[model samples]
Target: MAPASPAGSAPASPRLPAPSRGRRPGMARLEVDRAFPRSPRGVLKIARTLVALAALICFLASDAHEAYTALAGMETVITGLFLLLYLLRLDARMRCLFWPLADIFNSVVAALFLLVVGLFAIIIKTNKGTLAGGVLGLILLVLCLVDVVLLCKKISLDKARGRSAPAK
Candidate 1:
């Protein structure tokens, strides 16, 4: 017979409870939604993205070549930022990606860029194509303005709460 084991000893071949469903034993898993449907800023960011995308689509379908050219760069920047934020949101879990100051800065820049592009495109020309692009561009600019306002409010609230700004 084997020597008596110490009191309260576990089995010689210790076994872990069967891993849940598909995960391997000892793997750490963090639960996160496929998309950030719960975050307000995430929704707002997505709305801004849709507005920018609409402007781009209008430019493509419109006859206004000049307006499209002028607005292209600004739209690209907004779209890129949107994609980055959205991709990061997939893994955000419960962690706050809070960067009120940075968001404010981005919102301001996007608003200014959209405003300038919209005005420049309108002053330069107007056709059926330009009309479509211009109208969409205006909408995009409004969304940017909303983003700026929301971000500014968040920044002020954060400051009042004594939270330092995010690192550059």
Candidate 2:
């Protein structure tokens, strides 16, 4: 048998401070804009995302051409990115770019393309899914136009008020 250790002869173990109760280890605290989702732009963006997703689904179900499916998918991603940019308040942090103008441009371009794709989808009349997708695309186009109008009005209002439009 090994010899017994003497009292107080054991090695000391270091003690560490306890972690804070409010946060978990290695997890970042997220700063969410609580009011963003309730704002008009946010609502429109949410609607756009849903509509784009529906259109994409319809095209996929109907075996439409890849171009149609790709357009819907691209719109979904772009809108989602914009939504996240606002929702997370990243736009405020990144002040170099004018977000409103970019948003308006995106809306206009998307509307134009959606118009052509929607019309083509309807004209082809390959199946019910294509028809449904076309209708949704048209609806999305309307929403995009509305978004552009709202943004433009907001910018003009800010200019009239003698103050620069806020980035957020």
Query: Could you list the CA RMSD of all candidates, in the order they appear?
Result: 6.8, 6.2
TM-score of 2: 0.79
Question: Tens digits of per-residue lDDT for model 1 on 1-168?
Answer: 877778998647767787489887776665444565456666777776676766676677665565465465456565566546555543234236554555667777767766776776677655665556666677777876777786687667878987655455
lDDT of each: 0.64, 0.91
* Model 2 lDDT on a 0 to 1 scale: 0.91
For model 1 the local lDDT of residue 33 reads 44
lDDT of model 2 at residue 10?
64
Distance (Å) between predicted and true CA of 93, model 2? 0.7
The CA lDDT at 93 in model 1 is 43
Model 1 clashing residue pairs (backbone)? 63-129
For candidate 2, write residues 67-161 as lDDT tens digits.
88999999999999999998988877778987889999999999999999999999997999999999999999999999999899988987899
Stretches off by above 4 angstroms in model 2 are 1-30, 165-168
TM-score of predicted structure 1: 0.60
